[model samples]
Target: MVIPETFFAERTSLLKASEIRELLKWVAEGGIISFGGGMPSPATFPRQQIIEAITEGISEHGDKLLQYGTTQGLNELRSELKNFMEWRGINVSNVDDIVVLSGSQQGLDMFGKVFIDEGDVVLMELPAYLAAINAFKLYDPEFVGLKMDDDGIIMDSLESVLKELKSKHKKVKFLYTVPTCQNPTGVTLSVERRKRLLELASEYDFLIIEDDPYSLILYEPIDVAPLKSMDGEGRVTYLSTFSKILSPGLRLGWVLADARLIKKFVLAKQGMDLCTSPLLQYIAYVALKRKVIQENLSKIRGLYKTKRDKMLEALETYFPEGCKWTTPIGGLFIFAWVPERVNTKELIQDCIKKYGIAYVPGQSFFVDESGTNTMRLNFSYPAMDEIEEGIKRLGQAIKERL
Candidate 1:
């Protein structure tokens, strides 16, 4: 049978396939200790509570859950998220401003569909989330990278990019960021930077899509509010998820925006799935209603804190002199930089073969430049003992390479 070329959208040709997923497939078959993926430890998930919540939902809601539901998602689920955000000092007056997504990744995809068009400009941190890069790339959006440092993406660099785009008479659809505990870097943007970012967004008249799935897992008390909290004009779209906190299996998350924009997202979501799984939403609602999410988050925060500390400590003790990494206040991963001569892409394979340990090269995270001498080490999944050994293996791999 012959196939038509028009069966696929022309925009799909723009995206390179996901490198992380390819690496993970190889790593999973290697039978080695791994720290590659930024996956939370399933050991920390509230399996029992999830079971209870699902049972309760089935008992209480029955076929209502098994049937089609509103495109805006369950009203009670949206209400629960609104209250949760309110506790964080973020105010969303209309409950309709929120839309339920399968997870924050789906939220990114939906936003890409609604806001991004052919040749539209989308700004992102230099080394940003790969999934966001992949999701947005498929829409043929032009990506501009803002400079980054230990304190997160530099404000001046962001301003320069925005100014340049403005001068060229270009309209940037949105800037994507994981402000707190950013992926691949694990650096939190300071409160001052966060406010400055919002100011720049206002000046440029673009949107900031703040993807913050890890903020709630902070190890220390955070004084900085979300960009959405400071946004009075409804320019920032906030996305959060239950995946990192309660259960990834649930695939439940929420998107907060202006009611008008949310209406667009609702239409986009309707085309994607009509609605998020009713059964999953009902179970999540029950979990929140019963305080199961809170309980699970507490447990996860404590466990990941210890894991993060152990990995940081190992970096200090085991890595060679001049090696550097960020000491994140909270998060599952840390980015390590070796001397410029050392290529982490090659080193990771050596570490896997020689020491039965693995980590992800930072090259895959960047949009323009490939970071060959850097690596991102995930600390959440490995136990304390395993972390020590993994670090030792990684360090040995580096030393041998040198």
Candidate 2:
């Protein structure tokens, strides 16, 4: 018997496999130097501390942890998270304003479910996070791409887009951004631009989704602050994860938003997973209470900074003239633009087969279908030698294509 496509939901047709995950499968088979996934370096994980936390938690509270938790999340973890957010300068007046998630990825899906209506305008960066572009697409919203420079989303372009949309009477549902050390591009929104973005949101009467997974991983001392901290009108919904600071395997994340909005997310989440794992939430609480997560951050920042510098050096020495990439101050990726003639999507399979190197092609990250000559490379996962060797192989592939 054969299964028919019609048997599936109509929305299943909109689903597409993540290109980064597909590349990861090839990397798992060996012999590929990967710059595909935004994976944290294993060295950064506080293994001994995590082991101790798990042992202590299970011994002290095994009976409570093994049972199912509340739909909102474990109360102890939520209280700890409130304090954690405060340390980062985000004020949370009550624990009810936060909801733990399976991962920040779940929060993205929840946003689509709770907020989006078909054909509602959802603004995005020119080349935004691929996973976010895919997540919001399932809701059938109209995605409007905004232009960006090194400093991040250009306010002029945003102002123009808002005015044009107003003329057509199209109100944006929300503007989604990975503002600090943004994925795919690694450019941070400047403080001035961040202020202007908030002003524009207020003027246009729209919400802002600030997906901030990389702010804590900054390699340099910058004066930037989380958008949620600056939000006086409660217009920004902030999402962050333990994936960068701790370990991705635990799969824990949280969202801070208005109490009403969090209530909706909790309702939506009840249907999705009922609640995030109680066992994992306990581990995170222990990590925070012991100050293990904070203690490990400096080491993560130092290690990633060295990798970023090495990759930048390799690009300068090996990549051909006219090829350019961002000098990321932090984060796992360095997005690059090859000569206009080289389509990275067409070149990826060949790169994997012949050159033994892998990077995420940039086209899928663009909601507008525009970044054909670009790619995003991860510096945090591969070894130092692999960073240099992979860049050499990638440069050769582009040269041959040219």
Candidate 3:
């Protein structure tokens, strides 16, 4: 008797698997130069210091680190993160309020677990971080896509959405934003827009989840404060990570929210992995103490800026005329737009099949129906030479289709 077995929660059915990661698996098989993933260049990693820290980490706290540690995370490490953010202008006086997660991605997942419920309305930027869409989808939250421009999420559209939601007798639970150096599109939120958003959040009485991992890696200094920093009543749940600047393998990130909300997040973390890796936490602590973090960050900013510049130049030179892309002030991605008739999903397939070049279609990043002609190109992993060659190959690929 063949009984069909269905083993899954209803939430799992709504979520789509990562398209870029799935594509990368096959792209890897081709041995073609790839730019589909947002991986940092290994050359910029502080391997020497990390090695020294790890060696010293185990030597100083072998038994304590290897074993399970506090659910809230290593207190000393959280304090360091607090101090770091304070320097950056996020005003957090108490370190106990922060909960260290495996990474910022995990922090997002936990936030969803705490806040999102079936049928609750959530506002997200159109063409946002695919992982955030997936994470929120797991809770079956009703998503509203806010339009985006060079200054970041469109204020008029945001107002319209809020008004519409209000008229319907529904209020949004939260508005998710990437603010500085957004995913897919590397547009930084302007100071004016930031204030406007905070005002909107205050008026509507909804939270703003500010995901800002790439803000610190900017090529030049930008005087924009995090949404959390401007938040008066603890309305912003801010999250950032060490994945881009230090190392992804560390899997270290922290979330800053009101102490009340953080309690629930801590409980969620308790069930997830008990705690983040104590060994890595120790290493981070030592690195922070030794001031290796600042040095490594400087190196990363310089190296990635060079890569980004090369890619931008290549795009200018090689891509067809009339094609448009944002000149990112910071971050690993550059979003390009072709004609509306061009289906980027199909283009991705064709490029991979014909030219052996890969990119993520921008459609997947948007919750509302938009961005069909858009694609996201990562400029972080490839070297200067690879950026030139890859962009040339991609340009050649696009021209062939044209």
| TM-score top scorer | 2
How does candidate 1 score on lDDT? Answer: 0.85
Once model 2 is optimally superposed onto the true structure by TM-score, how far is the C-alpha of residue 315 displaced, in angstroms?
0.2
Best by lDDT: 2
Local distance difference test values of all predictions, in order? 0.85, 0.94, 0.87
Question: What ranking emerges by lDDT with the best candidate at the front?
Answer: 2, 3, 1
Which residue pairs of candidate 2 clash? none
Count backbone clashes in candidate 2.
0
Quote the lDDT for 251 in model 2.
Answer: 96
lDDT of 2 by residue, 1-402 (tens): 799988999987888999999999988898899999989999998889888878887888899888888988889989999999999899999999999999999999999999999899999998999999899999999999999999999999999999999999999999999999999999999999999999999999999999999998989999999999999999999999999999999999999999899989999999999999999998899889888889899999999999999999999999998899998888889999999999999999889989999999999999999999999999999999999999999999999998
Candidate 1 residues 309-343, lDDT tens each?
Answer: 88988888899976999888777779889988998
Model 3 TM-score, 2 decimals: 0.97
Relative to the true structure, candidate 1 reaches a TM of 0.95
281-384 in candidate 3: lDDT tens per residue? 88778777778888788888988898899999999999987689998889999999977778888888777777777888889898986888888999998668
User: Can you rank all candidates by TM-score, best first?
Assistant: 2, 3, 1
Q: Identify the runs in model 1 with alpha carbons over 4 angstroms from their true place.
A: 1-9, 26-30
